[model samples]
Target: MAVKVSSQKDTYKATAVFLVLMGVLYLLDKWIDFSDYNLDWVMQKDTMLLYAAVTFLWFKSDKSVGLILAGIWLIQNIALVTALLGQVSTYLLPLTLLLIGVLLYWLSSK
Candidate 1:
């Protein structure tokens, strides 16, 4: 049907946008020096946004896959995130945001 075709097209468009976003973010993270300006928080926040976008997309396709990907993302980012935290209690905010991202994907999953 036309609706399904349009929906698939939209999905493809979203995917392309997401890929572009990831590429830009990766380049910024690798090539730029946010820490030099005490802007590391900005990079961390962008990382969260990237994960959220990926999780949301995966969730729309498959809930189990979304959860799995979220878990894998968390595991992979743990060390750098911990170092980013730089303090015990400060870990709560970012970790909570990541968990909330996972939860949002789980809840919005279809």
Candidate 2:
């Protein structure tokens, strides 16, 4: 009898771990905001970071997640446009950060 096994590439495993960690962080931040709306600043910052982490995690192996990020990228762009239209506030630091994250993710996937 012989034993056979399969192993994932280190990059894939690393990306999965990164994605899980980022997802968890985002989930935690979301939970934290449920009780207090005053933490908007901090939540937004963390959310951007979370998006970055998630992007890095799904960089190569997961096209679905990448698509999701693409959607977010579009949404963020629309937010900026809406701000220009006077529909949203001009203080878009967080969305800008998240846009950077989206760009980074796109780069990593390439």
Question: Per-residue lDDT for 75 in model 1?
Answer: 68
Error of 1 at 96 (Å): 18
Report the C-alpha lDDT of model 1 over 21-92, residue by residue, as the tens digit.
667866886887668778776557546555655745653443443455566666667777677767873868
lDDT of each: 0.65, 0.58
**Which candidate number would show the highest TM-score if scored against the true structure?**
1
lDDT string, candidate 2, 53-76, tens digits: 455445545455555665565565
Candidate 1 — what's its lDDT? 0.65
Model 1: how far residue 92 lies from native, Å? 21
**Segments of candidate 2 deviating more than 4 angstroms:** 1-15, 30-68, 81-110
Which pairs, if any, clash in model 1?
none
- Tell me each candidate's TM-score: 0.40, 0.30
- Residue 63 local lDDT, model 1: 43
